[model samples]
Target: MESEQFRRSWPFTGVVLWMCLALPASAVAQDEGARLSALELLIRSPQLGGSDIPRDLPGPPGGVEVPLRADASTSSGAAMAGAQAVSATTLPDAPVRPSSGDASTPGLSEEMSPGGPEGSSALLSEAPRTGVSDGAPLTLLPESSPSRSFQVLPAVVAVVPGLLFHGLAPAIAGDGQTARRLFAMEGAGLGLIALGGVPIALTGASRRTIAPLYAVTLAGFSVFGISALANLYSVVSPTFDPGVPAATLPPLELEMGYQYVSDTSFDYDHFVSLGAVARLDSLKLEAVARLAPEDGNAQVRFGGAYRLLGAPEQRRGDTDGSSLDAELFGLYHRYPTEGFIVIGGDLGLRGRFAMSRVSPALAGSFAEASIGMSLQGYSYPGPVSDGNLHEQLLYSFGYGVWLGRGGPFKGEAMIFYDHRKDGFAGGLRTFGGGVVGNFGLRGRALLTETWGVAAEVAAGGALVGRLSLIYALGGES
Candidate 1:
């Protein structure tokens, strides 16, 4: 009897222990279910219009019931009222979730609902939004939209049409100011060409008019070349500064050199040449002489020029101005081997016009025109011919350039026509000979502060070339 009672009590004890273990597990499961339900309610509340909670919703393993909210009726009522207000004020384009039974709303999709499986996938796959405001859509441009490249068409225009059109390239590039200036330059060039070309054609290239006509022709071509270069430069480098300061010459300068004459009629071949100039305010005095040491052939000229119009000496800085001058000169020449001597005086007026203001490349360049009358007396040896006054007309038109600034290495050059037929070659013409003309070029280069070289050449009755070493006594070097 005692053993049976102990067995019965053991069974009961084991049953009670199993019940205690099962109770705690059921409570833990209930707590987990409650938390999960709360989270689902929070997520779906806004999209669902805060409707009543479903009674048949499944719970955890313990079958516990969890309230959607502590004050479900009041909270749901307030949330429903807020939802109504939002629906009335929201933008028409805003996305909306589809209701299971409602068919009146447009643009509503079940996939957009918070509780739908597709909604989460769509959110994950959506592209990132630009930071632009919804009212204004963003505009996009290419990455290289602002990049620039040089165009070959402009260069072609500059070289082809540019030669004759002057400013066509700049005009095509939309630079009106440069175009106008280039056009004006072209017009001037064309005018000069006409001025030079017409006379040469009319003269039939006669030697009597060849010298001055060639000088004019050369000047016209110079203007044309400058215009062409300017056109190309304007197109290629629109922003370049093309300016050179006006150069000033000093009060006095002296030069000496050697000369070589290549005259078929003269016996002298080599000469010593000397020249000097003195400036006194508006008056300039000049002297030049050449002697052939071997043959005793010699020539000397002394002259002065008085400024008559335009800027004064003190205003030499105005390089782009005009000037008029009155000139007077006396000359003496002897040809011992040829047995003759000549003495003469000339009076003339000179006009100078500067063109640098029109083109930078033409800086320090000037056009000059002179006209004069030379009264001369000729004497021959052995009393064979009597001395008589002869009248000769003198005239020239040419161009000159100051090569550099008034510095150590400055220089100048001139090309001119000499119309006076009064030398030994003139004597040949005087005796039933052909008409004559002379073309001459003279240049000087200062190699140092006080030392330089000089050269001159004349072609007409004779071809003469002179080279000399020069020393500057007083100047603005």
Candidate 2:
């Protein structure tokens, strides 16, 4: 029984020894397989193996540290060492992994890091850091090519034949929409002039209907001028970005200035000028006063306008700077040396058109016009003469440019013509002083939200210049 028991115990001990020896060998093989799998996964990873992928390697302690060298000899040495290390761990018949020859293959170097050397391999140099954690491909914007007509033809045509035809430039430039609008505008203007002019002629320039008819005719002329400018602008617009209108303006403004007038027909030489403007929702009111202390000559004029179309002065928004208004004004003048006091009233229509609507190149430029009639009577201090009521045709037109981009320093400068002969800067004395009006250049700028400056130089029968200080209140800053 003792022999049998010993034999059984010996077999059991042999079995335990065999299991202890085989278990460690099996675990070693599994670990090697897992390591190979991990290496394979890393080499095939999208982040590491792509054509545009960066060649940076994670360093030491927790990662497989591999060094890459620029020189062929150093690279060969590193490869040999890596191969040896793999061979020492694997079985004799184990397959060796092949190395890739692709330029995008990951390599270990300072050039691969985010703070890498500026001078790196051509492939690495092409990659740009896209504000990401690491490398990204560089992207460049495409350039645009301008067409022949876009660059040259339109502008030329607009100048050569556009002045008279109004729509010729845009039509030839293949802009049917703009051309159609321009043609329509021209036709409308001609029609209005005919409508008003025909009646005035048939009625023998009758005073009973001259006021309204004159106003209509002036409106027509204004429309024609606007359309002509627009035609030129439309063809030239491709070269520039358009300007935007002011979204808002000051509600109230006050002005004071000094005026010097050199007129052979008038005795007043120096005067004090005062003016004020008030803007409501859709209405604008203005007042002007000029006093000559040395000559005892004084003039006061007050007026208001009601908006019939487009945005108000205080809240224009994104409008094209186009507007139409009906205006009424009253005037008083005392010519102390001439011994006459003139009192008058006026009624008219005023309109403005933004040049940008016609073309981007003309942005910040505009056209303005007003037509009306003034009725006045002269009162003499001494009874020596005729006291008959006089009628004067009033018309004005201007071309202006906006000053300064949108900011506190916003304003406009204009070269204008005024056809009234009763004011301090009256019509030219040439040809009986009634045929030609005064031409002037005026500009106003707001230096800050509340303070500004204005200047005007005018010529006619007299040379007149005025400089004013402007103070603004309320509304938008």
- The number of the candidate with the highest lDDT is 2
On the 0 to 100 scale, the lDDT of residue 110 in model 2 is: 43
Off by over 4 Å in 1: 1-247, 310-315, 358-361, 381-387, 423-436
The C-alpha lDDT values of all candidates are 0.60, 0.69
Name the best candidate (by TM-score). 2
Reference-based TM-score of each model: 0.49, 0.61
lDDT of 2 at 451: 93
Model 1, residue 337: displacement in angstroms? 2.2
Tell me the tens digit of each residue's lDDT in model 1 across 257-334. 787777777767788889987778789899999898998889999999999986544346634546899999999999
Q: Compose the digit string of candidate 2's lDDT tens values, residues 222-315.
A: 6776777677667655555434566777999999999999988776699999999999999999999989999889999999999999999798
Clashing pairs in 1: 257-468
